[model samples]
Target chain A: MRADTEQDILKTELWWTALVTAVVTAIMLAIIYAGLVHHINPPSNIETVDPKTLHLTGEFTEGNLGTRVDGSQITSRIVATQFAFQPQCIVMPANRTVTLRFATPDVIHGILVTGTNVNTMIIPGYVSQVHTVFTKTGDLLMPCHEFCGLGHSQMWATVRVVPEDEFKPGPDGRVTCDAR
Target chain B: MALAPHPNYSAQVPPRVDDAVDDVALERVMREVPSGALALSLLTVGLLLLAWFLMYAFVFLPRGMVG
Candidate 1:
């Protein structure tokens, strides 16, 4: 109730407010820096496809699921079925920007590559795409994080990242783990 | 002498001891308590910020970029 007590409380409140603002500003700045400098962002590709006919035709056909290089662009397409990725293993060159496109014919599935920032959800009626450059040259586990069925734990694949010199494409410009 | 009527029982109740501090003492208490609380709050927030920055720099940054 005293003037001095009220003044002190007001000062403390002002200091706390300033500190909170500074912390929020610092977090925003950090996010902006990551976006501008490191190019880190969330995967938000929204392409639709019929879940029933996903495997029958188009880009998700069984024969077309793998790493394919078209000129300067490298793309890998995979279909997430009940308990496995179509191609159990995929080959990609390290330090190159690659697009990973995923679609699920059964249920909602999500994938996260170990030790990397690549994480996205593969919905049944839509395709999930992630663009990333793998820096580490090794096999990274890509596990289906969303539990779909009794075999969800076994639903995983391998991302085989090889050196640029070792990434050999076949005559059709497709690369697979078997050719390694 | 004759006993006084009713003996003034209501007046015999004791004053609250906690509220009897002088102005100077009350001022010191008000000042010290909030300052101590502020110090504790600042330390907690500082440690939280430190942990967040450490994770961002060491774990998240080195994981590489994806979009």
Candidate 2:
């Protein structure tokens, strides 16, 4: 009777162990596959833009600006600081596609374009790309959201959106501000 | 030996149990967390998430036209 009871207990423990091991293994495998495989082959970069595309390269650094007119401290907001490109001055054609790639010369930076609902983080060694379809013609602001250093709150970029015909033509027939 | 009065015959025994289960083994097993391991785990997870997002952008989605 004692041996039988011990055998039953051992069998129960063994079954539980097996079940737990299988569950744990499945979870680990799923995490690995999702992180390693999915990350290497994300779906965003495969899309391409047509000719006459505006290719702009921007570098962001930490700098400071004064407060607002109302005496409201603009420096208090996370989005108010840190910008390599002035988003408000970025001129783009309405009803067209635009691509913006962000890079940092020193530290990690994050670009947040509030008007068009675009956000991306850029690292020192990595180039982050943002693609947007500008369906409207208006002024916008692009601010840095990353908490880099003391000057992080002052980084700002300008974006200007103009009509398709009004875009300035580059020497290479590309509507780019910077030479490719 | 005859006791004069043992409290009440119908009264229950004292609440204090006669024996307690020792858990020294379990305690020893639980105290082995390595330093900075949690932070490292979080960093790993963040990097992994970033990699996955990039892959999803560059690979899985169709690259033809804007909807």
Once superposed on the true structure, which residue ranges of model 1 sit more than 4 Å away at CA?
A: B1-26
Per-residue lDDT tens digits for candidate 2, residues A1-180, read: 245555655665576567557656765675466546433122243322221212222223222111111121111012121344422234455555555654444566786555444566665555566555555555566667787788777777655555766655443333332321
Highest-scoring model, TM-score: 1
lDDT of 1 by residue, A1-180 (tens): 698789989999998999999999998999788878998888989899999999888999988999999999999999998899989999989999999999988999999999999999999999999999998999999999999899999999999999999998999999999988
In order of listing, the candidates' clash counts read 0, 43
Q: List, for all models, the DockQ compared with the true complex.
A: 0.58, 0.04
| Candidate 2: residue A113 Cα off by (Å) | 1.3
User: In candidate 2 chain A, what residue range of length 10 has the lowest lDDT sum?
Assistant: A67-76
Measure candidate 1: CA RMSD.
5.6
* lDDT score of residue A122 within candidate 1: 91
